[model samples]
Target: MNDDTGGGPARGVSGGSWERATLEKLVFATLKEQRSVRRWRMFSRLLWLAVLGAIAWYFLQQQTLGAVQSTPHTAVIEIRGEIASGASASADSIVSSLKTAFEDRGAQAVVLLIDSPGGSPVQAGIINDEITRLKGLHKKKVYAVVEETCASAAYYIAAAADEIYVDKASLVGSIGVLMDGFGFTGLMEKLGIERRLMTAGENKAMLDPFSPQNPEQSAYIQNMLGEIHGQFIEVVKRGRGARLKETPDMFSGLVWSGPRAVELGLADGLGSLDTVARDVVKAEDIVDYTQRENLGSRLARQFGASVGEGFFLAAKASGVQLK
Candidate 1:
């Protein structure tokens, strides 16, 4: 009976010891899982903090640069790429830069560094008017230094400058307007497809590529283009005065080399930004007053554009341009 009782106690103790060991193992495993989760959460938080810190630093840097003042320098506003309403070389951005440059006490003169194939005429006209107004108000001479190609709308803005400088090999003309598109009517006919378009007014579908060409509409568009062309010619005449040597093909949508342009009185002489700054403005040091879009703004613009790309394409198909 004693042996039996001893055996029973020994078995009970062994079972209790096994249960305690299993419980200890489970507790340790649970603690390890919690520790891993906590580490990951901490790492994620740190990563987000780092990104926020970087963005803050970038904006602060830009603000600091804009606030700092320096000795007398030539303030440059870059007009590169297509000068559309929402583009980098837009009238609003250029005009804002011009205002800042003109207002600054350290700015000796304003320089327009142009390199473009041209874009919207309306935008160019706004910039041209502002340049003239600013020049009169501030009494600061504005110089246009052309690089590569300065044509159509680009030249429209440059016309407001006191003088225009260009490289010898640069293309400096194409003083004209255009409205470009493709006619898919022929292709649709070949593919045996039908176009069912609805419009509120007869003229609403005037330039629709899928519809047959209307002679009356075409004539009206031609007349309107001629009027705009006439206005462009008058602007050039006013800007160049007696310097321009008018020719039959001067405004015939023809591009000219820089040297040829100077001979034809389209430009002043062969010069670059550096030479013009040192000789004309008398300021060797240059400071850019151009307003640039920040990273966040660019990313937001890109995201919005992606969402509206289809709508933009449809409108662009029938839009007029100055190129």
Candidate 2:
């Protein structure tokens, strides 16, 4: 029995040391956690600031780039996409740009820089009428300079111009109207699917793809298309006048080479935007006068439109669409 009571003091000191080590580990872990939280918070704030800065820069850039100057130039309005109501080449956008270009005293001539396969006839008609009206009011010559393809409604718009120019390789005409869709009645029968369509009006579901075709409705649609076609032909005739060489196949929804188009009087000559500006208009400087929706605005509009479209599609029956 070598005095066990003396070891009690040593045990107490060892226990105290163990307690101190445990407390130190806890404090270090707590500080590390706090540091990690601070780093994450800082990173989040930096990311938020970067986003704000980017948005600010985009707006500033748009403001700077969209500014119009009172300098002499050939004001060019680009019709480079579909001519639908919401498209860049829509009557609204093109007409607005044309108005600006024509109103600008510095603009020597208003040039329509067209590169499109065409779209809505209604949209084209609006643009055409506006072009004619603006030309008469402003006393400024409107010229159509084709790049890739200017057909159908695009040609309709070009017809309003004083002169139509094209590159040798460019496709220049497709003077026609069309309504296209699919008939799914046979497919539905094969799949044993019943189409239960209800409408308040008799002709409400007249062109429904899921339903059987009505002969009267078909004839009506054909007559409607023929009338529209006649209107298109008359417009072409009025615009081209003695320049057009009358041919059966000319207005048969057929596209022609730029040289052929020029020969047929669909186009005045083979010339580029540069040539038209420098040689024809006598203004070398070119300024873009096309009013365009900015990226952010377009994105927002498209998103909203897509959401609305889903509901519209669900509620409506499939039908014919014009191109």
Candidate 3:
């Protein structure tokens, strides 16, 4: 049979170098067989690159959409969520929002939308101080529109507003100070758990759960509450001025529904954010400046806050009140 070019395998360079010719043919055949694999691999890599590019584009678009924007023409700020020390929705957040509103040339008046049950008295006072400062410095009118629940420290914050509004059913008031925790001395005894505590002053651990309540301790804690209460009362008096019709029972740490709140001068009007913006501000446009609490921290706070509030309400119901 002919091995190459119709000639049998021969000596080197004989019959047109039959062996070299056969080798060339074999090499050419291998290259032809590999061509499809190389081309397909390149195509697949290109396709994957395109897919990754699309995914990156989608994420970029989502981020832009999720970012908060400053509202032009009218500046509306929010103080929703719990107000606490160093919280995202705390005094600093509201203060910064007010500052931004005042600085914005398009903002006619700063709108403060509040939705909180209040928090630290110190935080609330700081917020009130900042509101006063911003108003004085900027000479801009600020309105506090209450939503859901603007009680206690929330009202303290709202008191600094030029006007106040609440929904018909929104909970308001709770104009008092409180501190609640468990007394676990008995529980510790039952659980056989020893509580190790140290303090320079005997009164330093007055509120400690593991410590037994002393008469002097009770007196001291009451005095502290009274002092905070007085500060809260003064803030409300200053904010509402003569509009506030102070009742004997109003400021006893009692929370009320919006209707009673409006009737008692705790809240000026009754309506939600939508109604207030449309009718009160006379502008449909609104902006939010409130910072949302992260899920982890928010949930962590929920239990303690709710339990403390439940006890506080029970105490208030038993005869104590707030205005």
lDDT of 2 by residue, 1-323 (tens): 35678888889999999999999999999999997786666556555545555665696477435536577789898998899988778888888888878888889999999999999999999999998899889899999999999999999999998899999999988999999988999999999999998899999998899999999999999999999999999888988899999789998999999999999999999999999999999999998888766665554454555544443443342343423
Candidate 3 CA-lDDT value: 0.74
Which candidate comes out best when scored by TM-score?
1
Clashing pairs in 2: none
**TM values, all candidates:** 0.76, 0.73, 0.66
Writing each residue's lDDT as its tens digit, candidate 1 over 1-323 gives 99999999999999999999999999999999987786666556555545655775687588547734468889898999999988999988898888988888888889999999999888999999999999999999999999999999999999999999999999998988888777899999999999999989889999899998899998899899898888788888888888999899999999999999999999999999999999999998888888887664554455554435433443444473323
Model 1 TM-score, 2 decimals: 0.76
Ranking by TM-score: 1, 2, 3
Which pairs of residues have clashing backbones in candidate 1?
A: none
lDDT on C-alpha atoms for all candidate structures? 0.86, 0.86, 0.74
Query: Which parts of model 1 have CA positions greater than 4 angstroms off?
Result: 1-60, 63-68, 295-323
Better of 1 and 2 by lDDT: 1
Model 3 stretches astray by more than 4 angstroms: 1-72, 189-199, 291-323
lDDT of 2 at 154: 95
TM for candidate 2 is 0.73
